[model samples]
Target: MKVNVDLRLKDIPGQLVAALEPISKYDGNIRGVVHHHDDRVGGRITVNVIFEVRSEQSLDKILSTWKEGEVDIAKIDAFFETYPIQYLLVGSITSKELESITKGLEAMENVASIEIRYTGTANSSSRAALVTGKASKKETLTTLESFFKQRADKHNYMLIRGLD
Candidate 1:
């Protein structure tokens, strides 16, 4: 999993190295690190580290090590796994129908996020939209594709699965 950790460390020499060493020691691959030296408060500075670990267990070890070393952890964010799907829709679909499509897809189980970008003028009757969705499971995306196909058939819209 990819993780972003925000840490507060004392404004003293060797603090950054001490805070980062455990991540490597526990087999975490460091992607980026930003040390905010100027933004100091209460003699401490904030450092942001983005890293990836093989499993949650390895991340837990690094976090515990930091806790033992007295590293003040402010925040941690982990990116969740997602299976993505995209569709190109072209037809005389109305705004109300588009909204209904978005809402129905969002209500599905394991659907993480949905993004829709429309092309052509809104005033024109013929419009195109790129609908992108990410789900926690691949099967969920497959279900979404089936659902979209049904909607497209009923509405007489052209639904292309992949642009290429």
Candidate 2:
């Protein structure tokens, strides 16, 4: 079974390794990890780990070990499928508008994560953004593309989708 674990650990040296050791010990194979260093709640950092477990018992043991180590388990999700998407946005897009679009994308059921990169002066009327999102299905991707197209039309921007 593939599992996505969201954990919060104190911002101290070796905290990430300590939290991951239990997963290894319980025979959980790590697939990927996303550490949000820029995001901190109180004194803790949020980390998301994707791994595969052979049995339910192994997953339970890993959770138990996390509790014993004082790692805060924010969430645990069983993920079966996902798809990567990337696109570029051109023409007048402000930070506020970009945030609104990204928030809307994040609210979709199939969407997992959204990342954007933009570089433009405050006074510039023309700006560009590289938008990336992960969706669980092709239908979701179609929906997202439609949403982006509508948003760009409303804002008089150009939406260029990347080839997968």
Best by TM-score: 1
Total colliding residue pairs, candidate 2: 0
lDDT of 2 by residue, 19-116 (tens): 99988999989999999988788889899999988777998899888888789988899755667878898888988888898788878887878798
TM-score of 2: 0.50
Q: What are the per-residue Cα lDDT tens digits for candidate 1 across 24-73?
A: 99999999999888878788999999998877899999999999999998
TM-score of each: 0.52, 0.50
How does model 1 score by TM-score? 0.52
Model 2 pairs in collision: none
Error of 1 at 140 (Å): 14
RMSD of each: 6.4, 12.6
Tell me, by lDDT, which candidate is best. Answer: 1
Segments in model 1 whose C-alpha atoms lie over 4 Å from true places: 85-164
Provide the lDDT at 62 for model 2.
92
Which whole-number lDDT from 0 to 100 does residue 142 have in model 2? 85
Residue ranges of candidate 2 with Cα displaced over 4 Å: 1-79
